[model samples]
Target: FFAGNGNFYTFVVTATTNGVVNINIPAGVAIDYQGNLNTASNQLSRTFGNEYPVYTSSNSGGTISPVSASVGQGLTTSFTVVPYSGYTMTVSGCGGSLVGNTYTTGAIVAICTVTATFTQIATAVLPTVTTGAATSINMNFATGNGNITNIGNQVNSKRGIVYDTSSHALPGNVAPASSSYPNKVEEIGSFNTGAFTENITGLTSNTTYYMRAYSYNSVGYSYGGEVSFTTNIYPTVTLSGYRIFSNINTLNVGTALEAQNTAHVFSNSGDSFRLRFLLHIANSNLSVNGGVFKIQYSLRSGTCDTSFTGESYTDITSDTPVAFYRNFFSNDQVLLTTNANDPTHNSDTVVPQTYVEKNNFSNAIATVPMGQDAEWDVSLFDKSVMDSTSYCVRIIKSDGSLLSGYTVIPEFTTATYKSRGGGGGSMYIENIATPGGTTTGGGSGSGSGSYLTKCSDGIDNDGDNKIDALDPECHAGGTLQGAYVPSNDSETVAPALPTGGCTQNCGGGGGGGDLGYWIRTVYGIFGSQFLRNSMMGSVIVSFR
Candidate 1:
């Protein structure tokens, strides 16, 4: 060491296969050993160390082989990190934020040290929201620590962001399809944390709508997603008039009034419909003893042969016979006038007063129109009679056409007695002698009595005792019984006189006609048979 000098000392040596000859120098002195000494000769020389390259046995302290230390802490404590390549041997804890580098060269040290640091990146911000023009706006939070009130307003800035309200309008501004329409929407409210419940109102009967949610907070208003819905409509019906049979002529006798027919239908729902004619009637007098009205007609054309007289009249040929029975007085005559006049007029007398006989009854019938119905009105009966009397008004249908038939009236009742011109003996004697004279005799059988004799035949050759003047039974009974004087008139006469017979020996003389004169004693067949059993002549009485 030298005074007042910051320098080092050094030494130099010359070496060969022999030994090194060193020349020492003082501190701060520069020594130059420039002479080249040859040690090739094998002469006697001092022993020198073996030839070796410039080498260092141990590195001194503070020897940083490559680079300098960085700015941040680079701790390498055993509790923190294991030693790695390029790590410094002086650190005890891991380093803080990385700043620069500090490299080393020798074999890796077994100490812990700081190396590098990681950087953080920022994310995009949520989009702004807007208020809805219609119903209340809503908002919601997706994935952030902030307000989630207005769910519709807070549109997510990132993907998977969404908001919704439970209620929505129909597609066409229409009310909901449910029975409860616009009012139903008001139940739910608007919100954020979860999906919003927005109940809108004031919707039309049938309309559609479009909407979206809106949210607002310290950040701003954010718009939600869009959606739409539709509602339902109703149905209605219309009608024309409710008139059924408003103008029916109820007072018209023997006339079947018109029935109720047309109608209208309406509906709200789209459905198919149709209708049919229905009829309802009250109590009627069209029957005997409340019996059903009779329709006396035939589909074929011909008169109904109710009488067994074998007389062929006209035939009935009606398709839809709607005729009903009616009652009338026995003396009533169905006049045949040829003119189609009113029922009250003489011109309307189609058939004159003939005793509305069986053959004199009407035969017309009627039928209703197609797709139409038929109804009847009957008159009430005052008294219940033993014999059934029927008068029919028939309506006919032929090949789909309507034709009416005349009504037929028939009656039966107790026969009444009617006085003619003479007594029993005179009438009998006159009827036997003359072909058609009465018993009121003359001196030579002259006078109206002569005419009566022509009809008075006790034999009943024509099956009519008073011998044949319009005897309906002539066409009925043949050659026996008395005459058939149809009681169409108020009075009808009996063919045989009430009293006539031979007073002596019951013979054919003595101012008496014959024994057969007493035959009138028996009225019924049993009485006549009893008379015959007694060995006396059987007598059947005339219509008394």
Candidate 2:
């Protein structure tokens, strides 16, 4: 017998043999009321002694427990249903109710079928990222920035910047390791989907670098567009101050000569001179490289001006400055001392024999490594002539560029010595007691010690009311002696002798009556000696 309801059809067959029977349906053998042709069905085999017919289940994108089972008429059965990852399940054709992952048949009377359907689950895609331009770029460090618009389906395991000296392709779908890309920086705190920053360090100065922002997750890494930035040049070198040494004496002690017109006096021609320039490095990671030093000088007829703008000078080439390489000492070790020894003393070696000359300017008299706050010393011989010489220094880099401003040069003057004739003599009058209880004779003078010279003496020997250094003749005659002293040694002259009788005592408590006797007594002693020296052809009388 055959019966049907819409697309559901059933057939009942009576068993006549005790053996099994097989049934098969070919493709397009049957048609539904909606004019849809039936597809091929699997062969069904049944034993005649079985209690009920077989129910069959099939699935796509999923699986079901108990794919086939024999059930009694008017009874129910259940099966476990499972769907693949990223899919969902459903049952049809077998009139069943599904709760959770279990599906139960409504009553089975004949052979039926169960089908499980699954559709893919929608998921999030890769994240969107952007790379920002470099900020706060300097000699050794810079800041990198990035933003993550979306984080994708997985949490980011790593996020930061990747940089290199050369341009490169985008990173692969994995976090880049140091071996593959050497320069990388990661944020220190918690990961953020929005804007973030990474402080990149250990960079080289005056170099161009390429970079990109990147983010990583289970789906792999995502990168922003490439960007480039060049670091700034090394920090500018500076001159802190300077030291001028005339042998062991420090000329500019306790004062900065650059701000004043302090004089450096040279005592003798045999003395050696040196200059120590205090150099400073503004940044700890930077250094002043190989460079040459030059000393410029000008001869001034009068006093030197306090500032460099008031004078013109030429570079010194006759006594060329020599650059030295100090072997073992650091900058702080040599510069911090009150009086640093000359660098040429022991472990120092002259680097190059001569410095570079350009445009008639002997730019490099000495070469120095001004890597830190150090004493950059140069040697100079003493001046032979008496002149007021002004000096300044200039520094040049290896590329012939000026480092900074010139060092201030003070006016240095040579000392003067007194000159006298061959046959000069000095007359001494001792034991002369003045009314003021002070003695004056063969000594410096009353109330004055050896500091009193003929020009500084208080006497008006020249008969001009102006006495000692105040006298015009004292300063007008010879060369200037020192920074503040007059050069004329013979400016003072003896006063005229008394003609009338001594109105005062002539020593020994004698009055006017004993004046003639005392005068002859003084004449008899010194007069004969003066006559004999006069006959010998030369006589110079100096009375004190």
Candidate 3:
């Protein structure tokens, strides 16, 4: 290579691979303009190199961060352009921004690089992730402060939390651009991030979730450290309850204005007993959400009945047995009113109480409504002392719709040592009519002594053709069990139950259970059974 006497000439040399390449001009390879020959050769050697498909960056007024990258082929990388002190910046290429000063490159099919121009100005930054929590089966959220502190200038930006069970990928991590979360992943957004929280919701339950607070501007998504939380698991609905009254009205005891502590329900023929018990119900998610839940009752009497296959209940063919609300007792007189707080009068449609009605078959006796408070959902029911050969009082839900999964209906069987009947016994709750005439309805045997003996009055108060013990009213223990009287009427009002209530051997099957009151009756088989288990001394024999 020589520059002739004219001026200069150009020569081209290409590098073939990675290594060194040398170009040397031999002796006399050049001549000076003054006709002087070059004594030694001017040597020029160059080294060739292979492609760097991963690393590339640039800096102008500011610095482009991840100053250099080494992520292998096929994957993407995020880069942030932090401005120098007293300098403003701009970016170009790789789907990156210079204004925001941050850029996340797409897939690394080849080398990824960017160029920027930054002017002298104040510096900027990224947003801060403050706090987060998982609250329900389908909802969770994160709170933060969004400011261009360590990040860059923000134009139209996206900010929220991206979450997963195991993966820590951002929302835009996938190639086709979706999420990698396994469950149904939805996000809460658009209202206002300035409002302080990024709501993460509509995810699955009983699962471990991973989340990262994020802000996506021209700078892709700026994420916080990965945070993890597990969702709450709600248990399914389960129905459980025991008998309300065996011998005592447990509802009137202790904090137990509700029924509790009675024998496994044992119904007796010709015996009057009141229904006073509790019901534990849960998981109404399958029921009404923000509405009142209603309860209903049905009975299957006569013989060891076949299993209830959930049918043929509410068909009271004749006018004698239409469903109607009643006071604590089964009154065909004035139906019980709904709750005083009821604005819709829903309780007017059925029984205000939840008693098990007597039936020889699958008969729907009463339907009652429940209140809103969950803890106080349990209430006591009153049975109309109706006796049947083999009867049952079963419960079910009446939400004007059907329910799913486990059987919501639980039955209480009544098979006891029968007690001789006497209508309007001590067990009668709030009866108006009379046996000897106590009710305003002017029932049989009306008298001042007669409390509410609509049954033994020998008058057909219910017009069911039956009289006293023969009537279902007597089965509630109208006569023999004596009548039910309030136990705690200020305690100053003289206990109305045992004294004011029934003085006769109502059903001849003395009382038993809570309130510790024994019914005044003839010492019969059932009476002996209750006394033997609860009162009588133990029996033993020894030989010497």
Candidate lDDT scores, in order, read 0.24, 0.49, 0.36
Q: Give me candidate 2's TM-score against the actual structure.
A: 0.30
Q: Which lDDT tens digits does candidate 1 get at residues 70-121?
A: 2212221111222234333342122222122343222212223333222222
**What TM-score, to 2 decimals, does candidate 3 have?**
0.27
RMSD of each: 37.8, 27.9, 22.9
**Where is model 2 more than 4 Å wrong at Cα?**
1-127, 178-181, 233-544
Candidate 2 per-residue lDDT, tens place, 1-544, comes to: 1226445555677888654678887767667666666667789776565345545556567888787777755667888888898787777655788999888887776688776777666575667689999998866678998998788855676788999999887765667672246688875344548988888887878899988888876677788888899986665555444455543222222222222223566553223344455444444323222223444555653444334455555555422221121211223112223332322212323222221112122112233332434344443443223322333444444344555543433345543422211122222212122223222212121121122244533345567654333344543322111111222345553222224442121111111112122222222222335334432321121232
Span of 10 residues, lowest total lDDT, candidate 3: 535-544
Q: Estimate each model's TM-score.
A: 0.15, 0.30, 0.27
Q: Which of 1 and 2 is ahead in TM-score? A: 2
lDDT of 2 at 39: 69
lDDT of 3 by residue, 1-544 (tens): 4456535545578877655566775656566667665654467765455323444455565666666776544455667777777776666665544335557676555566666566776333434333245443321222322222333444324555556679644444232135554433223333223423444555444567776555544434455565677654322322233323222222221122223322334443222333332233233221112222233345544322224454344422111122211123332212222332221112222222322222211112222223211111122222222332223333334434322222223334434433232223232222223333221111122112212234332234566543333333343233323332212122112222334443532211122111111121211212335434422221110111
Q: Which candidate is the best by lDDT?
A: 2
